[model samples]
Target: MLAGFEKSTGKPPEELSLPWKGMPDLKTGEETVEIFRSWRPHSMLFNLPNGNSMALSHEDECPLHPRSIVVVDDVYCIFLGMLLENTCDLRSHYGLSRQVTEAMVVVEAYKVLRDRTPYPPDQVVRDLQGKFAFVLFDARANTLFIARDRDGCIPLQWRMARDGSLVCSDDPNVIAEACGNCCTFFPPGCIYMSGDHPLNKIRAITWEDDEGNISSVLFQVDLFTRLRSIPRTDSSANWAGVTTVDGE
Candidate 1:
């Protein structure tokens, strides 16, 4: 994964800080937020179930493209970048007041995809037109939905820590420092959903412009506890053929 990441990002793995061979004392959550404070002033950390954690932060440097977090009905979302289309439409569709933030729109969208739509998660993601990346955690359901824009307009990366915690961030340096060569870029145009619900799945999707080709790949943790990607094709008869895992 690191080799592929370096090849695509043009950043050598050796340049990253020494990898943490074992777990550091990050369970308290404060230590993890501090790592991000070096880059942004505003930071918040959420301690997730199963010893997992999420840290979000952003600066006031770009007012036009602001970062936002919204919690509604036990669903928490952190969004970066703008939803150029369907922001208002989604707000109206969900009967959300105009005062609601963009993060709320994302939460409603996820709910629709998870509960209402028969379309695959990747299909809903592919229809979205914007430069954005978001992480939504449904605390009540113990599920997580993460996605990046099709063009890779916003940065996002993830890696499994030595302690088996999943770490994700927009800053590659932070991810590199924590997981070193183990880190990899969260593939563009991919949606990763993991939950106890039978309908949830982890899918990494790709599309080619020249031929309008589309493909889907499933991500699974093998018996050896290694993340592996298996290529798959779309089947109308079994749209939800992929498997899902609980929050690791």
Candidate 2:
């Protein structure tokens, strides 16, 4: 998997040399799809949002990924981040504009797969670094998969320590900080997963009340509290006695 990812990305796997033999694996090819679906489930976060987004980051400037598809245990997932540069209707479901739609098309596309894949728990984390991200989960196969844009603007890494635990990183320092070892980077447009992590719990966020008036979601008190935080430059003292006799 790592080798294929390297070839696809045109570089060796982020952490391994010519090959990536260090990654973990659990042979599940022989398992029945129904049995696998009933058992361990995973998540697929192709390019998850960095969670720290900058307002200045423009859509046209973002990196674009070619239309591609990868299969995880016969579960098919595809990625086509945008229909064209800075334009997409994908986010109409979320009430975002075309640029925001194209910008988030990658994320929404991944989420669509993640939701359909039917993984156990957060077994597959389809995290996005910022520029682009996607994920596909196959609860029926206990596998998670992903892909990313070509640019290095986004970050991803993982590492194994003396204890055999796999430590992942979005920031390089996290690996060394937690594992006391150097971290390995996940190649761009590559995939990764965690095996044997039980998914006994899964929480799905659902929206049901768009029917509720907008006022129901708004809190005037909160707005007033925020307004109070603004610095005041003018005062009542300035107008205490400034009125002209003729009111001119």
lDDT of 1 at 131: 80
> TM-scores across all candidates?
0.62, 0.31
Error of 1 at 181 (Å): 4.5
lDDT of 1 by residue, 1-248 (tens): 01111111111222111233333532212333456665555567555544445556664425555677777777777787888767787678779998877778778777776684344555335435678877777766666677776666776666443333455667666555544444455555556665322233333333333645322122332333324333324542331223333333
Give residue 222's lDDT in candidate 1 (0 to 100).
Answer: 31
**Candidate 2 Cα lDDT to native:** 0.30
lDDT of 1 at 59: 47
Per-candidate local distance difference test: 0.52, 0.30
Q: What range of 10 consecutive residues in model 2 has the weakest lDDT sum?
A: 239-248
